[model samples]
Target: MTDSIRHLSIHIDRTRDDVYAFASNPENLPAWALGLGGSIVREGDEWVASDAPMGRVTVAFVPPNDLGVLDHDVTLPDGEVFNNPLRVITDGTGSLVVFTLRRPAGATDAEFERDAEMVTADLARLKELLESA
Candidate 1:
């Protein structure tokens, strides 16, 4: 199985707490994420959401001003379930978010390319939000 990982980092002129609060809240996801819908509900330590490419996602980890992790079974348009791990970290000034997808051993290269573009655009939106907020 080839593990594909994509990294995106952007600097914003905002406090760490502000950035974290905005990004961590599921309600703000659609503001940055494309083609995502539904609200995020917190069940104990995990956050759940629907109408996403991923049927449901669980919050994996959330650390103060440092990191947050999310794990979920993501279904593509072709009905493929991809195990995705999303990690968010602060650069002590801004933040860097990465998405690592574990594809079925021989996944197509297009998969990585598509996700990279999507994630890059998401990061750009995040940067705009943080800078303008």
Candidate 2:
């Protein structure tokens, strides 16, 4: 019973490649994704963050590419998996980074909105970081 898919996008005055490269790196998660704000270490084929919610978690990102497909799956310590869909598209002036956020089952409306706001802020942070660089 997940809620609607919420899309939060931010326009950055940077090339699509640059934005995608920076945003897609798991090591750079803390610089933008507030929820996983910590130094991530490689665990075999995945990235693991020990200090994240539910203790340690594993993040497996889609292989980097030029097409701007930035999808990843986060595995919680309790074995729940959250799939995140993200993308970067080039426009005339710059790039558009879009993140798809979904409300987990049983989340209240307020909680869902709060999650959207957090993701919106995170995307804005990523835009600022990239545009400033």
Candidate 3:
């Protein structure tokens, strides 16, 4: 029931566990997830992105698990919620990080493309950071 969905992926020269461990930590999000915000802090059970592009938002992540599922729900100040599907899977000796981006309802072509570009940049940043570590 969405306009479109795009699976953007990046191959990082790091183990799946290593990639997931770093990416799953909300504290490290600011280093790569620019689209999310410039910073995130845990407030009670949910992480709050005070400087998010869409303004202050609450990010609720799924419980940590061995499946490399990094799914999270981002709640905007207006109460609108966006579910982001993310996963890190083993790819040869490295990791393949995949982010599923769903186009917003009634979004224009340019908006969808911009979203995909942002996700791609974030993933690239993750790879660069992890590989350099």
Candidate 3 matches the true fold with a TM-score of: 0.96
lDDT of 2 by residue, 18-85 (tens): 88889888889988887775678898988998887568889998887879999999899889999999
- Model 1 lDDT tens row, 24-124: 66668778865455565667765555566665544333344354554445445455555656655666765565556443456588876776677778878
Sorted on lDDT, highest at the top, how do the candidates line up? 3, 2, 1
Give the per-residue Cα lDDT of candidate 1 at 127: 77
lDDT of 2 at 64: 77
**TM-score of every model?**
0.62, 0.93, 0.96
Per-candidate count of clashing residue pairs (backbone under 3 Å):
0, 0, 0
Residue pairs in collision within model 1: none
C-alpha RMSD by candidate, in order: 4.4, 1.7, 1.3
Candidates 2 and 3 compared by TM-score, better number: 3
Candidate with the larger lDDT of 1 and 3? 3
lDDT of 3 at 115: 93
- Model 2: residue 75 alpha-carbon error in angstroms: 0.8
